[model samples]
Target: MDQLSATLLSAPVLFFILGALAAAARSDLAVPETIAKGMSLYLMAAIGLKGGVEVAKAGFGTELLVALAAGLVLSAAIPFLVAPALARFGGLDRTNTGAVAAHYGSVSVVTFVTASEVYGNTGFAIAGFMVAVLAMMETPAILSGLFLARQKGGRLFAPELLREVLFNGSVVLLLGSFAIGALLGERGFEPISPLFRAGFTGVLCLFLLDMGLIAMRRILKTRALTWRLALLALVFPVINGAIGVLVGTAIGLDAASAAALGILGASASYIAVPAAMRLSLPQADAGLYLAMSLGVTFPFNIVLGIPLFRWIAESLGGML
Candidate 1:
């Protein structure tokens, strides 16, 4: 609990909370949209390059394959498990529940980025291939959500689902950059080292500033999120984190890698999934999922879940 509290009060998380507060207070301060977008691109590219460099050093192996496969399975399975419970307990209709559950099952790159920072600060080493794993995990839950929605006869266009799953901005940029980085290898990365390495954390800070503003804005818009929904957001991540830890342990992940996996599982997708939901599940109230995701789950994972998962993973690793 002390660790959790410390994490919650960490500089990045607090800055995010401050951003939320500023938004709640309706402050005029804002990140320019273009600059925000540019920051996102830079972060994605740099992270991809870094991951590629690490992979070059480590070389691809069975652990990477196993982790990737586990990520895909989790991404596909979690939404099916979560949607029904949300529908019954939260009073979300089939379509809305499915949409929301999909986001929960998907990866949040920003949250992953933050977790990596937390791990680094704590002197834990994480796998370089985890970034690729993160990218792979983004879309399968979306596909699952669409399948579940269709089973209920929800009105969704096939093209819209395709676009959402394959062409979403974050998905495209993340995978595209990962491919570029993998192709470039060590020699290529050296020339781009200053661009990808030196500027990474600074760009992340700026992005979080924007995220803080956005989270704050969303919180204000949904001022009275129901206890049921809020509780769902909080509890679901714990459950997901547990599953992640188990998988990570089985795959022989070290403490830091397991913690990072826990963080990924616990984090909800706010950006890509929301955009997809808006297009694919138009009848579903954006307020419910977006609020639960950006407003509730994202903050919870960053402040509380990161440390808690890290501790749990460490304890479990020691026992093993």
Candidate 2:
């Protein structure tokens, strides 16, 4: 309860609520789109770089490899469960159902970022190699989404999509920055710490304000998110997140890394998955997937899921 309350009152979250409420009221308060985009890149870059630096400090190990394997398994397999559930519960067709499944299977960078913040606040040491795990998790879920949708009707393995998934700006920036940070080492990161480390939360607050505004607008305008689908949005995260944490613990990850895996498992891909879906499953309804991911799931995870996953991680981590 204390953790949840703290999360609600956190500056970044408050700013997010402020943006959502302002948008819902039809107020004119808005951040510039360009600035919003810049913030997103900055956040991802900083996160990737920090992770790379940590990996450099720790060096490659058996635990890192196992965690990555566990992450890949979850990312690939989760869509299968979600696809059938959407069909059975949400009454969605294969195209829309698989598309939605894909979103849930993929990782959300923002959610992972928020989880890391909460994890830090709780004084748990974060796993540096999880950023690599984050990048690895994005593409396989996309492939699974395409595969599931293929059973219905849609193009599969389009050359363009293959390129897009690999080279998407977020993936590129994160991987590229991670590589750079890895090369720089501790001494190299020191100069940039003032920018990337010191100011991360302030930047995150601004970025989330824009995100809250966008999520609220989607909730208001989109009719695709039914009550049934909305309920699934909440349920899937808890299940997937728990599974992810258990898998990570079994594979020898400490509490923080396991929780990071849980957060990734729980997050839906609003960015990469959406882009792939548009090209691959052209018949899939954008409003449906977007509304469920951006409107229902994103808000829930950011507000409640992060803290819940951390507590689970702490408890389970201690047990491990």
On lDDT, the leading prediction is 2
lDDT string, candidate 2, 1-320, tens digits: 98889889888888888889988999877899899889889999999999999988888898778888888899999999788889998999878888999999998999888778766876866788999899989989998988887863444788999998888888898888888888898899999899999999999999889989999999999887889999999899999998888887778788888888989999999998999888788889999999998888889889998788778888886775
In terms of TM-score, which candidate is strongest? 2
- Candidate 1 lDDT tens digits, 1-320: 76777667666777777787788788987999999989888877777777777787788899889999988998888898788778888888777878889888998888888788767766777788888888888988887887776654545457866877788877778777777777788888788798777777777777887898987788777844788988999999999988898889888887888887888788888878878777777777788888998888887887788888889898899898
Clashing pairs in 2: none
Alpha-carbon lDDT, every model: 0.82, 0.88
User: Tell me, what's the RMSD of every candidate?
Assistant: 2.0, 1.4
Error of 1 at 17 (Å): 2.4
**Candidate 2 segments whose C-alpha is farther than 4 A from its true place:** 151-155
Among all windows of 10 consecutive residues in model 1, the one with the lowest summed lDDT is 149-158
